[model samples]
Target chain A: MSPKVSQEHMEQRRAEILKAAEKVFIEYGYERATMKHIMDAANVSRGGLYQYFSNKEAMFETILEEGLSLELDETLEMLKENATSYWDMLMKTIFGEGGEPDDEMDPLAPAKLEFFIIGRNDEHRRAYGKTRYNNGLSIYAHIIEDGQRSGEFSKKFDHEIIARSIIAFIDGLAVEDAMLSREDLRIKEQSVLFVEYLKMALGISEHSTDGK
Target chain B: MSPKVSQEHMEQRRAEILKAAEKVFIEYGYERATMKHIMDAANVSRGGLYQYFSNKEAMFETILEEGLSLELDETLEMLKENATSYWDMLMKTIFGEGGEPDDEMDPLAPAKLEFFIIGRNDEHRRAYGKTRYNNGLSIYAHIIEDGQRSGEFSKKFDHEIIARSIIAFIDGLAVEDAMLSREDLRIKEQSVLFVEYLKMALGISEHSTDGK
Candidate 1:
């Protein structure tokens, strides 16, 4: 193969392996998952897996980075477009296209929780987690700040604190999802209530769609 | 010794062992902590530690139950007395005696997170977690319900959902605390913001002290 074609093929193979690794991590959780399992699932030889990733932690980190980076990019793009109202923008950022909560949760949530919680004491993992958290925080803070600046939201509360609370609520739900049954989580109800909170804190009426 | 005295001695020893186990769990975290560590910390014989609790899970459960039950009882007693306003009672229940957020966090918080996250799939542990969650939920819900009934809080939102959000915020902070430095967690700031949310959702003014 030409050098250019070879480069493209290598990238495709790496993506394929990551897809398979994600399934194994989700199924068995981070602590229990093994690279051998990823190799089998990806239909790659042991050497092939090792050539792409050194360890499970490296694989998991890459998966998390890719997913979060995609989300961050999408949110930044939405903000630049300014096609949606601030409230709707915030909702879409949190709950995806419909901007509503349902019974569904990220399937990889438990594995992600395990990865961070289990490795919390490790300096490298903790540093990475902090960076990921700040990145997530910035997305929400940007929405709130824009809303405040545009007179769409009140300046009654610190935009960053409000943003941080949003992260807390979502992270808290992830923790609850791990421990409780889906029915018991009341994810939809809590989310609806949280929206009410954001509206009240932002001093925006529920009916307001000024920027829509 | 008399039979009654012997029984008291046994109870005292059990409490001492739990105290030592709590220390061990806090120092090493749940996944790494062992019965042997507890025995060494408590300065007890293998048989002595085993006599009161069958395993590490049982000991940890007892520690959690004891702490929560005590908090629950205190909250219930405060409610019966009607010695404080609804807002103060709620704040006190969440933040303890001063009804304000501070830098301190429960020493056992990380260990508790580890226990539940690691054993999330275990039938027995999951059941215990659900029960514990409900118990914690009732405390906040009760405060909100009483406030609404007494005309101190707004009936605009369901008290149960408000209560659940409070738990989510607190649990989310705990998760953040594990992965980030204390400064990064911004525990006090996030907590103060949450209090603002509770105020808005309940429709109570910051100055209100109707029952105080």
Candidate 2:
């Protein structure tokens, strides 16, 4: 008789597979990347890979879901601890860990675009995309709401609308980044301009230098 | 003997083919759309279609180029003739002929997104996309510059950055529209809010009602 695998061990194995799959997706994009690539990348047998994910879409979806949830949890935890200013919280949430715009875009952006745009017609994908959009929307909305409550942000515009606009700007940049060169995108300039827009919309003073 | 076609007649025939091809692309999107579909839709022989456009990509590019140029020409003519207010010009240009936000979105948006995002890795396609992006960018930038010159828009922010943000918002919305239902997007509400953002950024008065 073989020894049984522990539940904790299974979870660890699943996490390892997801990390490998993400790298494959980033390199090959959504359409070209295949199960075989993931298998090789993860160094797992066919049965082991299949045991964790039924198909490529499932694996991709799991990666996105897990990453988003993890980020959201960390953000909420940060807020609970009052460890950062509202401005820094907003910037970091939108622009990544540095909380400042730069030339580098998320490497997974192209694959994410392909997955959602190409699978748009599929009922399952459409439903998944909707949930993902809402989850993304709420992350920004929650921050703006907190800022507004604390009088750090103006209530001139609805918090949800402001949040949605932020998502639109970021999503738009991702779409452009997928097609245009970094130089053409002028990512830093655009981000700085958008930061100005956010400041104007949120009533943050231009001279406020605390967050930087 | 085959009749010799006049140059004007040939141009008209090409225009008809492009119109039909546009319909086919909207129906099937970029990847699934085929040259045969365009041939059938345009009621042209295979040889005739080939004589005009070498491939589906060329045909699609021609359609986009023609559409954008036509719109640009019309806009420039209106500006030269001083036919409308700066605010009206900006609104009509961004939100279509109605000049107000509504539930409707561009029907060709998904196809356009697919074309740009999928072909991003191709050298020739990348070149075309960059030109198209710059052309699109200028439309908004020119209007904002005019507004600032006329003292209608503020000069606090760079006109180019604001213009870039507008393009980003529209492109981002198109991406979202491809995957989400119309209701989920809250199109009109988002547009109204964006208009407010624009007004604040440009220093347009909240009570200005002449353009509406």
Candidate 3:
């Protein structure tokens, strides 16, 4: 009889599979990737792959659902904890609030770009984007709504619309970071300037010192 | 004997095919669509379709390329002709410098939103996005570079970077408009608002007077 897998071992095994699956899926895309490809990438046999997950779709759902949700969740959490001013929070979240990675550049930029392509061309129903929006939009809309409620924001326009616009702006940047010519893409400072302008659009008062 | 089509008739036929292609593309996306689908949708026969274009890819390119160049040229013309301020130019160009379309509440929002997704999605290769963005980022970069050279704007940042950021903001709004709930999408007014923000971002002063 096979000994039961420990929880830690199970977690490691799952991560190993996900890492393997992500590369394969990204390289091959969803429809073209198969269990064999994933197994070969992971260096696991068919039985071992099935032991870890049910099938390709199941593997995909597991991969996508957790990866996307976690990336977004982490970003939102940073936004929540980093609120000295509105732009501070946005910059922190977007430019990586956790401090520089090993590369000292945005590691997420590549993945975020990948997400935009995947999000747009997934061939899935619109529900996927809608669902992610519902999770993120409500949180962000509430932030704007709360600011308005607290008299920190002007009532010049709809916060819901503002939140959606901001999200869209971020999405746009992510896609650009992925697809645009490296020479044509904005640097970190340029993106920060954009957030400054966005602060005005959302009717957020600029942080006193950042006006420079 | 077949009647010879006039110059105006040929132009009219091309426009009709593009319009039909746009509609079918919005419904069916590029991969699933065929030349036959566009030909049928345009109410033109096989020979008529072939006379106008080589293949579905060529037809798609014609529809997207010419449509955007026309839009960009028209926008630049309005910029050249419109009244005094940068803000007004942005508000007008982005929010219907064409002025409200006759016989419609508003269709440009959805129409543009559709085109933007098609432009930004990764499903299309770099070359296709390259041509589309030439009508977008390349044009905006030229304008910004001109603005900086003429002393109308600051040059503290890379003009191309800022231009792409501004485009990203607009593209973001378009992306959001396409992806969000209809009731929740950024409407024309919000789009106008973002364009206003864009003017400020580019160091253009706000318009004191309203367009409408």
Inter-residue clash pairs, candidate 3: none
| Candidate structures ordered by lDDT, highest first | 1, 2, 3
- Tell me the docking grade of candidate 2: medium
- What would the per-residue lDDT of candidate 1 be over residues B79-187, giving only the tens digit for each residue? 5675468888898888877788887888888889888977888899988999999988987898899999999999999999999898898888888888888977778
Best by TM-score: 1
Which regions of candidate 3 are displaced past 4 Å? A1-3, A6-11, A29-36, A45-58, A72-87, A98-124, A146-158, A198-212, B1-16, B43-52, B76-83, B98-125, B142-159, B202-212
RMSD of each: 2.3, 3.2, 5.2
lDDT of 3 by residue, B1-212 (tens): 33455777888888888899888766565555678888889999999989988887677667666767787788878888873554445345545575421212223333433333334435565567666666666666776677677676667667776666666766666555555554656356556566566556666654334433
Pairs in clash, predicted candidate 2: none
Task: Please compute the TM-score of chain B alone for each predicted structure, in the order given.
Answer: 0.93, 0.88, 0.69
Q: Locate the minimum summed-lDDT window of 10 residues in model 2 chain B.
A: B75-84
TM-score of each: 0.92, 0.87, 0.74
TM-score of chain B of 3: 0.69
Alpha carbon lDDT at A178, candidate 1: 87
Per-residue lDDT tens digits of candidate 3, residues A88-187?
5544544566432111333343443333333454556356666767777776677677767766667677777677666766677655554556565544
Q: What are the lDDT figures for the candidates, one per model? A: 0.87, 0.86, 0.62
- Computed on C-alpha atoms, the DockQ of candidate 2 is 0.71
Residue A173 of model 1, lDDT score = 94
Clashing pairs in 1: none
